[model samples]
Target: MPVSHPDPIWVTDNDTLATYCTQWLKLDAIALDTEFIRTDTFYPKPGLIQLGTGQEVFLLDPLKIDNWQPFAQLLGSEQVVKVLHACSEDIEVFHILSGNKPAAIFDTQLAASYAGLGHSLGYQNLLKTLLGVDLPKDATRSDWLQRPLTDIQVSYATLDVVHLLEVYQLLQQRLKPMPHWNWLLEDCSNLSNGDLYPKPEEQWKEVKRAWQLRPRQLCVLKVLAEYREREARRSNVPRNRVIPRGSLWPLARYMPDNIHSLSAIQDMRHSNIRHYGEEVLSLIEMARELPGEQHPKPLPAPLPKAAKEHGQRLKRYTSQKAEELNLPVELLMLGKILTPMLRSRLEYGLFKLPEQLQGWRRTVFAEPMVEQLNQPEQ
Candidate 1:
């Protein structure tokens, strides 16, 4: 059983935060989580920051505080280890809100996977598995921006971080006996670097199958995607609001030249066309006129037989190894990570391991994978 503390100090102002910082500095590791709404806005509006230090939980109200210097310093502090569960988005929030990423981070979800718990385990399932406590799901959809949050909401939010400290401690203990602790540390260190925040525009090409389009379609998509990215930021609304994902296929396929043609496209509705029609048409025109060499050629699809064989082999190998280790197959290798590696090896006749497959990963996870690949078929 875990101890429950409900006396969370709600720090709303600088004076209160300063007082809290005095206490916060004394802590070695703090569990952290954030509540935010991103439905209406392009970027998430952070409503609350929940923190715990093995003793108590605190909810820092972003709506009330004007200065977050103390909070930023705490995140950047070398001595404090900030713990979070599946913290990619939370890290993004910290970067956007505090303009600094934490110096030390321990992501419990990642640790759970490496420790053979499971890959991408839901927080609720993880809590129950590790702590034997069932958390309430009622507040999952609550309006975090609403003032005077209910006791249930507060309790739910606080619980997110309160047990995180204990979970981290438990995972650390388990990982001490495993060789993958160093890999987890390296991954966590990379998460703390904040480099993922400012990705280059060309990187968007990797989204879905943007690379599969013809050169002309690729040109149009590149331009439209760039436009969408800029517009999403400028309008402070979600990218989907400006242009939905379904609309992209048509935009890339037709590469329409005028508003009339763009509006007539089946995927784009008249109302959306009327709203963003001219801009879309203009972008298409630009792509059509783009320099020939500048247009990206469609990447050739892999041979059907080889592609199918490699995928089956990789899946069988990973599944068997994961079963032997009592770990989830997905924990051993995510499809997103495996697809590219398998494709590269089959096509290029060179096996360049994914960055995630390197370092301690190669030792604990990749060695058996390589062996499985080399084994002759029965």
Candidate 2:
């Protein structure tokens, strides 16, 4: 049985947290995790933070305290490594709540992928696979915001960080003997930078089918989406409640000029039309008047038979190489990575490979695969 630390520290205020941070800076690394919910709003509501060094574990009540300066300083400190598991959301939370992005990060999920354990291994699966311990799943959906958290809830939350530290230590030791340690670190540090979190309004144009629309349609969709996002933020309501993606298509397609035209459209609620009809129509009118190529053409049909054959050849070669390495083929050559290159090879003939098809991927898998594909069948 694993030894338990009965007296886990709980910091409910800023002053006590400051002292903890001062002490935490002395540690080599800390394991961190967060509990949050985003079901009702655009942003996550941070409930509790579980942090563990080798000697102690802490549960921080984010709702009770305002200042996180000391914790932020520790995160910004290059001396201490911040270890987390599949921590993309946790990283976002840190940025949103504290405005501090940790400089040094070690993500166990990334490490696991590089270690050939497969991509996106769940936390419980990882603990079992690496440590031979079966964790309880009872608290998976517990209401974290409720006060006087049950002892079992505390125990479950504490284990999230406590076992995380153990997993980090083992993975670090295992990865220390491998060639991809620096690469993993590079990737983790890149993830630590939070610049990618707050996506700009115009960038939403990249969503699927946005380019397929006429300029007027694109403009209408953009305005509706922007309104939905802004209203979601202002009202603290879910984006779908404000305006569903389903409604955007018809509005953009038909370009309704009034509430009657809008109401005639399917899947639009009468109450919603009464409330937002004019605003929606006004946006459509603005889009219709925007001067440019009004109607854009649809995307070209999929590649022909000859192109598909080449793609198959490339996929087969990559699969064989992945088998030799005992790794998942998708890890080395995902569909997104291969599709464009395959299409280019078919259309353009023997082009210089993309960067993704070069480097470690190429040397380990792509180059040999390309050679095999080029060789004529006996």
Candidate 3:
């Protein structure tokens, strides 16, 4: 059954937004969603922000309104539970807008992962699975930053929050008795902390093929990635527009020493070479002279065949644990991190478990995992 949606109140001014904020303070919870564009920019350009408080749905235009302090205050307050669906980018929009994140959020997507619905469930799918309402997603790729949003665009935005209220109620009821409820909240709080957003200095950890570089090359890659991050933010352009990943791989692998060498890189755009060639050469040269302690440790080789087989056993154990708890197997043991954990044992002769295997997992699954890995191959 489709729920009735209130005609959305168009919020074009701060005064209207302030009034809504006041009304919001009287409520115990609200659902939020944002529409933004970031095709050519490092940060999301928030196009429209939508909110639902059971009785009303409203659209606030980010292009016209400058003040979000009142809304920010309400979001940062413990007085209300902010509800969202797949809120990682929405959190970024707010963080960039108000310099603070929302308090006590419930992400429907994350909740579904723990609800045995499926991992990373889509919004419309969740609504259908829970409420039997299937909403059309016509504006999935619309350019929201444009002026004069069509009726379809506005309707799409409204649907984003219309069902969130009921979804939260249902998920809460389902989670009421589960011990992993705290785990869900913990994950949501971490998303709101903006900890997932890495600093420019730490960008190298996410670079593709990072482990391919030796220590000296690793130092160069780090500096180069950091430089790209800084420049992308400063210029407010896409990171690839600054320097492509294809360019970085060769430059790091060869450890180029001069502007000529940097220029000769196959994928370095002529524009990038013209602008940043000398600086690139200088960064690589400086990295060559850095102290050993400053360089990163080289990544060890992949695990051997026997250890790879043992990883399959560990995977089975993780799946059984997840099944017992009604959690997604991915939540308990991420295969990406698991690969490295198995390789870590191969190289270090002991477990160097991933972060997921620590914390709550240590008590729940890691102890058994350690025992399993320690036993000799059968």
Candidate 4:
């Protein structure tokens, strides 16, 4: 059976939004979400900001209303918990609009994972799981930037937050008694604390097949990637739009010396060559001039045959521990985190807890994991 929902209150002007924000400040929690477009830009183009305080839903038009100070306060207030689901991109929207992400957040997708309901549940699936509500999917990709949004678009946006408050309430109840309750809060707090802009120098680590490069080649890649990162932000364009990833590795590998050499690399666009050819060559020259000792250590190779057996042991131990705790293995210890730890162990001959595993995971799994590795094979 279909359920009826109230029409979302549309707040387009400054005063109306400020008045409602004052009212929202009195609430214990609010459900929040955003609709944005990011097809070609470095930053997301925010179209709509949704807020539900249980009594009413408000759709704040990003195209209108300049006053975000009151709402920014509401978002940052430690008194009110801002509930969201899968909110990484939404955090970017909030930061761009209001100048800060929520100071306090209860991410339902993360909460559900901790509550043992499921991992990475979509908003629609979560609503179905908790409230038996099936949302229409037709208007999901609608042109939100267009004015006079269709009635279908409005309802779809309204339905998004209507059930979210209820979901937060239920998840909170489930989490209240768990031993890892504080761990969840700590993790949620980090969502807002994370730096919005990553360091440009470290961007080289993200290039495809980066580990294949020699140390000096890595130094060149690092310099070029840093330039790309800075230029992408400066021009407000995608990184690839600044320079494609495919072209970057070859530039480092060949150590292209001039515009002619730079242009010869596969996937190197002519516009990039024309626009940035001189600057790119200068950065490569800087890398070449750096002393051998200044170059980064060579990227670690694949695990040796001996380390492969140890990695399997670590994997089996982590799986068994996750099962015992009734925690999702992916949540408890992701492969990204595990691989680095294994690499450090292979190099140092001792298990090293990664910085990511420093919190509750260190408390729960660190000792046991080390013990499992230290024990002789049966």
Kindly list the per-residue Cα lDDT of model 2 for residues 184-271, writing each as its tens digit: 7867877876463344354335345565566667767767777767767777777666666567767777888978888877567876
RMSD of each: 2.9, 3.4, 2.3, 1.8
Q: State candidate 2's TM-score.
A: 0.85
Q: Report the Cα lDDT for candidate 2.
A: 0.76
lDDT of 3 at 289: 82
Please tell me which model should have the higher lDDT, number 3 or number 4.
Answer: 4
Report the C-alpha lDDT of model 4 over 85-149, residue by residue, as the tens digit. Answer: 99999999998898978988999999999888889988888888888888887788888899999
Please tell me which model should have the higher TM-score, number 2 or number 3. 3
Residue 225 displacement in candidate 4 (angstroms) = 0.6
TM-score of each model, paired residue for residue: 0.88, 0.85, 0.91, 0.94
What is the lDDT of every predicted structure here?
0.78, 0.76, 0.84, 0.86
lDDT tens digits by residue: candidate 3, 1-378: 664467898899889888888989889899999999999898999999999987788899988888989989988988799999999899889888777799999999999998889999999899999999988899978999889999889999998898898899999999978877888888788777647456888777776778778888888888888998899889988888778877776777898887777778868888887877778888888887899899977755456687977687788888888888878988888666777778767777776676654456666777777777677868
Rank by lDDT, descending?
4, 3, 1, 2
Which lDDT tens digits does candidate 1 get at residues 124-143? 88889998978777787779
Name the best candidate (by lDDT): 4
Cα-based lDDT at residue 214, candidate 1:
83
